[model samples]
Target: MFRCARAFSTSPLFKYAAMTCRQYSFQVFRDVPPLRQMRRQLLLDRKTVGFVPTMGALHEGHLSLIRQAATENTDVFVSIFVNPTQFGVNEDLSSYPRTWDSDVAKLEELNDEFARLGGDTGRISAILAPTPKVMYPTLPPSSEVDGDGSFVTITPLSRKLEGASRPVFFRGVATVCMKLFNIVQADRAYFGQKDVQQTVVIKRLVQDFYINTDIVIGDTVREHDGLAMSSRNVYLGARRRAVGLVIYDALKAAENAYNSGKLARSEILDAANGVASRVLSEQQALSPSERALYEVDYISLADPDTLDEVETIDPSKGAIISGAVKMVPLEESKPGEDCGLGDGKVPVRLIDNLIFKPRP
Candidate 1:
């Protein structure tokens, strides 16, 4: 960590350049206390900090957040921790991707890009990648937490949409985020818009608790075919990636309907589900055993604040239009369903959404 000798500099750029004019060297802290001490030092030095938290398996989606943080803050801090509290009994906690080396390499590449730009602010300030023992010190070493420890759970919102299926999700998210926000004490924190409910939950956590950090939502980064980039996208074999496109298509369709003056909730949601049904139906033409099984888990039109399903569009206060799709290979399909030779041998859950505020 470099100290800012000229803390009273008039120009922030000059101050950043004065502080860091050498080759970029970022630190990765494995524990909380030391990281907290460093954060304190950054504040004392008056350096602006932007944070991005992830569960590793970095992708362009994550990089976009990091990139934005680098551009906006004097120093960028990133945390990569795979919290076990979020996973369920049958979830893939054990098999979830943990590309630590690759993640770091990607960060280094981002740093190089920042260097190429010749800007001192874009360098990644540091990384906080802690172990389970570090995050849950009181608990024993295990893949799943005991749930006996303290956690942050926002009611009704946590029980809706994705929460309806994965109950422990928002609790884990809120808890870990609170801990990180406290430790980093960053000026701002960044999150992707892909997880619409998640962004709402985090916003609530920050506001209710009066956390000092500002929450910045980055735009969702998608693939060439419009698939919203996600670390879990790795689960889909090369051939089956298109099967997941239905969610985004549905969301865009819903957004289009809302923009077209279709204000009724049914009209908006029907537009979305209508698109999804057609996509799934076309896939159905494939023999049950030949392609992946697709099911629309939920198509929701809800209050941006409460997450309660809404009956109509509110143009002044935009609505959150979202959907989830369950994609499983026919071979791995449950006992009742006939099996098929499909692209995804494992079950992959896809969620995507867009806000519905029509243009004037």
Candidate 2:
């Protein structure tokens, strides 16, 4: 039996702050020993663990997943490690948001709500937030492809859609997630649908590896204007932020065209491209300081499962119409600074998807 270092209060009203405000009783572990010890204790006590892995910078989307995990399992473990492996060399690993203190506060706020509503039997038992150094003491040097240590790769699936853009993305994602699953060994894992391809890859990872974890996908949460909630959304300036909605707008356009008996794949893609063109025209009309913020990456219909581009939509099998748009700040328009493709313009790639099922 693994002896845990600490024990949570069994009282129904667990408190951390004063009576003026409710507080959570969840513990945060930065190393593996105490985390594993606690996990062993929870499993020995017949608890069903639900895991929500994240890269910190908590938002409403992340909160929704945590709430679901806490509600569904005997014990919930939320890991907040920003896996370095998942980020490409040109990606925003360094610029990525790292609001750890605020993230804890958000989780604690949710815990307080759960407690207030008589949350019992299931609570956010602990947080597994190890640093990259601690999590990967022998982590290889970062590279666009083929990092230092061994990695988990899902062929074909890992090489499509988002994979085509960021080659090493799934390799890093699969590796870190595999390590996390091995550590938590949770009964259920929750993921948001915003990264549809990522969810697909993880589901495949769980199946191919024979890991006994149920992958639960939460719906994609969006802003009032339809921009998908994402940590990188912060990088979008005010003008670019508004323009980011083009991704969702384009996906909706494609879905509408498909539902209206436009089954030809080229026609649907053209509809989405038209929306992108309209967005570009609008951006071009803005002041130079606020113009040139939108860049369309790719828009297409794909097999919902394989993520492969399709020639025609099969009414029986729904397809995912997804588009990616890269938005940059206006002020970063310099000769060698941010204008060129993949330059350090601090571009934010916004992606959105819609499931198109032909109506009978």
Candidate 3:
């Protein structure tokens, strides 16, 4: 009898063990199915993707866009391609920073936080990482025909300021960005306001081509000293760094004049020029190298939307006073030193914008 009891309790213990194992297995299976189903659903749903295309030495300006993208869309994709096509033969394409690994790491960290927030788990599915060839496929024999025949070429607006100088600059930017849009199929894209001209061009391109992606312009990031944050700032030495302030100081002078009721476009330009001239004159005593490596390219008050030069300030309409400055190399500097184009000196373009609202 005892033996029978032992068999029932011990030898038959396999049955009890099996029951417990089944329960544990069922729990494990239950946990997995939900998770798998959730993941599957996530994969199936069409996620709203956001894109921020940059030349990659990531900064707060870029991060601001990423954060904005995270808040607005289910997925955020960043492209770090430093497109060669966009840069003119004489431009700083080679010197442009290419901090790819750092950029990816930053994005990954943002993505992790985004995922934890129950924001899209797929918030940043892929970097849309591609080589220039992949992004800009093979073109036809003629340089005119871009790699893809269906390529978009945005012009007309390309005839202004920066465009006037860097002829093919916008085309390069437009093409690559469009290619990125095609690859990622982002529902929305972000850009910095600092590139006012670029912003204008991208907006026009999307509208003209009927590209479906929505473009968002983030505010320009600036240094505490008021210098606009740019990757090229790294080239500035200590003296040049201090001189850089002249750009903002000049803009502020214009702003002060406007605030003090200097409504005439000429007066505003004069104010800006005055400030810049005074600062430049003082720096001139220092060696040529000590002078701010920037020279007035042009200063004009213009219609904000159309970007056409305006004769006077119309309080009813907003206007922008924008221009570029070329850094002049010291004596012994080559012939092209003063101009941003063709070799002598690198240019640091400075633009300042303000709005004059009509008195109520």
lDDT over C-alpha atoms for residue 191 of model 2: 97
- What is the TM-score of each predicted model, taking all chains together? 0.87, 0.87, 0.76
Candidate 2 local distance difference test against the native:
0.79
Per-residue lDDT tens digits for candidate 3, residues 1-360, read 001101111222111121122111011111122323433444479567777888877887888888888788876667666677777666777666555446656776776677678834436544443445445457521123233343456667676767777777777888777777655567789998777778888998888778889999998788888777776665554445567777677777877777787778789889989987887788776665335556777666666666677777776775666656665443333343342232334444445444444543
Which digits, one per residue and each the tens of the lDDT, describe model 2 over residues 56-117? 88898988888888778978889887787778888877777777568878877887788787
Clash count (model 1, backbone only) = 1
Clashing residue pairs found in predicted model 1: 289-340
lDDT of each: 0.79, 0.79, 0.63
- lDDT digits (tens) for residues 22-102 of candidate 1: 233577776777778878888898888999999988999999999999989888999988777777767777667777667
* Model 3 spans > 4 angstroms off: 1-44, 112-122, 140-151, 288-290, 329-360
Clashes of each: 1, 0, 4
Model 3 residue 161 CA deviation (Å) reads 1.6
